[model samples]
Target: MQESWRDEVSLLPEELKEILDITAKHNRWRKYETINLIASENTMSPLATSAYMSDMMHRYAEGKPFKRYYQGTRYVDEIEVRVMKLMGELLRADYVDPRPISGTTANASVFRVLGKCGSKAVIAPVQAGAHVSHTKFGTLGALCIEHIEMPYDPDQMNIDVDHAVKLIEEVKPSFVVLGASVYLFPHPVREIADAAHSVNAKLVYDAAHVLGLITGKRWRNPLDHGADLLTASTHKTFPGPQGGIIATRDGQLYKPISRAVFPYFVSNHHLHRLPALAVTAVEMKHFGEAYADQIVRNARALAEALAAEGFKVLGEHLGYTRSHQVVLDVRKQGGGAKAAQLLEEANIIVNKNLLPYDPPDAIKDPSGLRLGVQEMTRYGMKEDNMKDIARFMRRVLIDGEDPRKIAEEVKAYRREYTKVHYCFDVNTLEDGKLYLLY
Candidate 1:
């Protein structure tokens, strides 16, 4: 096998072969070797990824379907329209535009429609898991919108409802944003929506991290709870190609946001993602519930296992977590930076995150590690598997085992899980190794 691989690469130019070698190494490392726990990341199923590669990648569609700014778009136009319908149905939304290109881009389009110079837009505070795009340092700042923060209740690990309502009523901002990159629980959508509406403001929920859970019924749909606009990435929990979507029940707001997506935020909209997005939406329609359930269950199990192994898992009073994420206050283990680096050396991937008590300046190293189970759940990991994962972390971080030795053990264990589950791919296991048959 080594000789054949060398012979195959010998025909290529040195630089090209080097690039291919790097790509192959990364794919093998991240996809098959490592235990990925990044909260904001997920893998698309085989079927969805197969559909993502197409001739549409080379084409352009500047405007909406049928009313395109370029020619040769009849087939793509139909696909785009049906994709929107598929997403709309999954979201239970009357209107959906799968054209923002990214979650932040979707937020930008909506923010542009709702705010202008000197206008205020209230957001869940950073301590409450607000994504950077919702803060003054990101899209809100780019648009010159004043970023007003709602009060966070550390005891509840969520927004302070009464104080947030009072602030909204007083400020009467143009819009309110909810959702987060480090989300673990549901936001107070209904109460905040009521307050925003009372002040003639719109409620925009960024479901970028939990779109799959929402579609699978594992989490509450923000739209059902009164969010005027729902923006999400098709990846993450949704498990599609990377892209953004905006869904809303309000036709009034939808029209302006749709227009903003085309003229202001995105130009091409990445036409190739449409078909894969549609395929994943249909897959979700069929298999999302079981997948999401396993993800949440694995998360809770992992959190418990980590705590049992002597780590400070956060949200213990709130049942650890209701979402796919399990955050740990790793400050006791030399802070999030050192803990995360140690785990990564053991072939366990996770990100250092800011705990609520940490100030914003702590962004570099933070005080917590954010772990997500959606990707591993897609690989068919169950609660027992989560325990093994936690044990691996304990060996690397607590027991002070050599990380290189742990990585070898991790690779051997990871070999048992390879094929993507909850998709149409027919897979089989031979000698404890999974193989896709079709």
Candidate 2:
């Protein structure tokens, strides 16, 4: 295929050639050379990717399955309906809507339903890992929903349950949001759910970062613990395509949120994502438990290794982490910006994040680095490989080695991990050919 692409590009204009060349270079670099620790990112399995590239990409289905505003959507209607069924089974939900295009869109849909102008919604603060969509700076602000932050407990590295409950009762918010972006431990969903319910408010749990673990039974399902709605991204630990899903057992809330997903926020619904998401749902049903277990184990192992390498790993008293993410205080290594840039230079990808104690003004250069093990775990990495990754980071950050040298070592070491695991496909990367860059 590379040879064929080269031949085809030979007859193309310089601009098109340059774009293709840059894309190829990126695929080679990210897919075959770097270690990805970006907590919010993941790659779809080859089977799912193949499904994603179907002819559905060229079509549109503007409304609910079987009731679409467009004709010729019969196949998509069936696929989308089945996808929702699979998701409902995995989520233990009475209703599942796969229409929202992204996690933020799902949140926007629900927030629109429960929150009115001048109404309040209590959420985990930014320091507690609340995604921006839940805050005043994003969706909530745009929709005119008052954003109230639940207090954070730094020692627990989670929401201050008792205080949050009290706040929820006092404020009597329209809803409460749990789950997080930099999540390390499960939120106090049950406790806050009771509080929200007592005040006649809904609880919206954003499982954007932990949906895979929840499905795998490694993490608690918010619905089982009394959450009214759950929103998540398919591409995080879930290992599906880039899309969003909303699930709930609350019949009263489902129809409105479903409508919000359509006429209010999303259209077309990215028809191509449906088949790929369905494929991943099938894969998750077969292998989610083992995959999720390995992801958590790898996260803990990486945290322990990094701590041993002189990094201030967070949540030590809570066993480092119970999810796929590991957080580290990189202030001693020159703050989150320098540390993340250094790691990226060494072919280790990570993102800077604000620690609990960080002031809001610190967004430009927060004190923490957020790392996730889900992507590498999907590539068949285990606890021992995590320790090796730690050593690589230590050499780059602590020992101050030249990043270019580390990059070469990373490339060589990464060559062996080109196959996607926990999916029913006898597929593997040959040379730099079958790459999933996103």
Determine which window of 10 residues in candidate 2 has minimal summed lDDT.
429-438
Best of the candidates, lDDT: 2
Candidate 1 residue pairs that clash: none
Angstrom error at residue 241, model 1:
0.5
Go through the candidates in order and give each one's C-alpha lDDT.
Answer: 0.90, 0.92
The regions of model 2 sitting more than 4 angstroms off are 1-8, 427-438
Runs of candidate 1 with Cα error greater than 4 angstroms are: 1-8, 426-438
**On residues 52-166, what C-alpha lDDT tens digit does candidate 2 reach at each position?**
9888998989988889899999999999999999999999898999988999999999999999989999988897799999999999999999999999899998889889888
lDDT by residue for model 1 (125-229), tens: 775689999989999999999999998888888888999999999999999998898888899999999999999999999999999999999999999999999
Q: What TM-score does candidate 2 reach?
A: 0.96
